[model samples]
Target: MRRTFKWGFIGVMVLIVGLFLDYTLPQHDVVRITDTYNRVTPLGSLNRLFYASPDAGTKPGTAAPDIRFIAAVRPNGKVIVYRNEDTGWIWPPFFKFNSSNLQAEASAMKSTADAPRWVMVTNYGWRIPFLSTYPNAIGIRAVSGPDVKVFPWLNIFILVVLALIVVFFWRMWVRFRERTLDPLIAGGQERWDRTEARAENAAADVKSWWRRIIRRGR
Candidate 1:
């Protein structure tokens, strides 16, 4: 029984750990974005080129610098705007923007302190495409975060199972260690007391018989 209980506890712990990992791991979803640039170059060369050539002598009316922006979600629920320029793509964390800033923009947007869901983006300086799909986006991937609300039923189920397991083990431990010896000790003590009382009664009866016999002889 002890071995069985130990193994059961170990299995429960393993299951709990597995569930925790399942919620925390990152999942990637890829989509095609229209206003995004998807060019790949040698890793270190792009940074050098951007630093070397900083100035272009073109007028503002000619054309804006060709750059694209895309949204990306980190594994921990942080949203980042990736600015793809002529040099290379840069990741600028977007969660820094507050609700006040989002409300000022003329776009379909929902912003809160920690949660920002932008249906469309209006900033045009970066020339990024507005991916219309909410579930999926182009040049941007939405990843899963460790959100407890996502699986309420599973969470409740696990919690209830764990509580019941704890209660069961506690009862077993009590029965194994405490209840077993109490009954034996109590029974033995009662037997000893009864034997002592019988011996005293027998001694008193023998003394009475001796006195009666002596008195009759007299």
Candidate 2:
């Protein structure tokens, strides 16, 4: 039962970390821009957190009055949609505030099927259709072709730094337990064990004395 709980907790932690990374880490997609448009997105209780917070860029809203979107199609025949918004010095720290410019660029980059101009879109977040969530596009750049290689250097550096920070804190915690908490616990345990040993020895001595007296009487 203990092992099962330990594994279950670890699984939960892993899933949380995976989702966090998926939501925060920037991803690149090579695709041909199909269209750019805006719509009044209604924010329900479930999907509201996925959208930008009010005062981040849009007006104060539970339902965003206007939300920009970019539509694209990959070479492999999959359609991907990205929402453009200002993160505005909040969580994830993208600080993006140029949604209008991005929309214009996306509109300009729209291409035909025969003469497709593949562009790499830098974005973060998830597209959950059920909750009506879309990834936020932070950047766009023209690539040579659809097959251009895009390396995620920013993600690599951030992950490495985060790993180092975790290792540093973990080592500190282990050292603290060893130097402070462990010794206190060990000292208490040793005192208890000594007291038990003395009690056992005294009990045996009393038994021996009682037995000798009984033997004399016999």
Candidate 3:
């Protein structure tokens, strides 16, 4: 039972970490730009975390910011929307500050369905229509065609570094248990044994004294 619980806890932790990395890491989408426009959208508590902050210098008001949007169509004829915004100095650490320039580039790349101009968009975040959250676009560039092979070197490097960090910490934890925690536990067990021995000796003495008094009374 203890082994099962330990394995279950580790599995849960691994799943949470995997999901966090999947959401935070940058991803690529190759699509044809259909349109680019700005909309005054109101952000609520539910979807606010997915969008950029007003302090990012992309939008001004907190209640309802004028958000720039890029609409694109995938090769399979499905549509996907991306929000253009600066990532500011914090969070995700994309350091994106040229949202306007990116909007312009996306606008220029806009093409019709007949003559599509494929582009690779590097972005992070998820688009949940139910919650009205859209993926934030970080960078965009023209590609040869819809099937252009785009290698994710940055993601590969980050994953490797993260794996190394996890391994290093795991080793540190094991060493700490062996060098520090195990010894403390052993010392505690020794102290407990001594305490039990003393308690037993005191009870034995009390019983002997009582017996002697009873004999004197008789």
lDDT for each candidate structure: 0.40, 0.90, 0.90
State the TM-score for model 1: 0.22
Tens-place lDDT digits, model 2, residues 119-203: 9999999999999999999999999998987789999999999899999999999999999999999999999999999999999
Positional deviation of residue 191's Cα in model 3 after best superposition, in angstroms: 0.6
Q: What is the TM-score of each candidate against the true structure?
A: 0.22, 0.85, 0.89
The better candidate by TM-score, 1 or 3, is 3
- Write the residue-wise lDDT of candidate 1 on 39-109 in tens digits: 23222432322211112232333333333335444335556454332211222212122322232231222
Clashing pairs in 2: none
Q: Which candidate achieves the best TM-score against the true structure? A: 3
Off by over 4 Å in 1: 1-151, 181-218
Worst 10 residues of 1 by lDDT: 132-141
| Candidate 2 runs further than 4 Å off | 54-59, 191-218
lDDT of 3 by residue, 1-218 (tens): 99999999999999999888887899999999999999988888888888876535444644688889999999999999999988888788999888989999999999998888999999998889998888899999999989987788999999999999989999999999999999999999999999999999999999999999999999
Instruction: Output the worst ten-in-a-row residue range by lDDT, candidate 2.
Output: 54-63
Best-to-worst order by TM-score is 3, 2, 1
TM-score of 2: 0.85
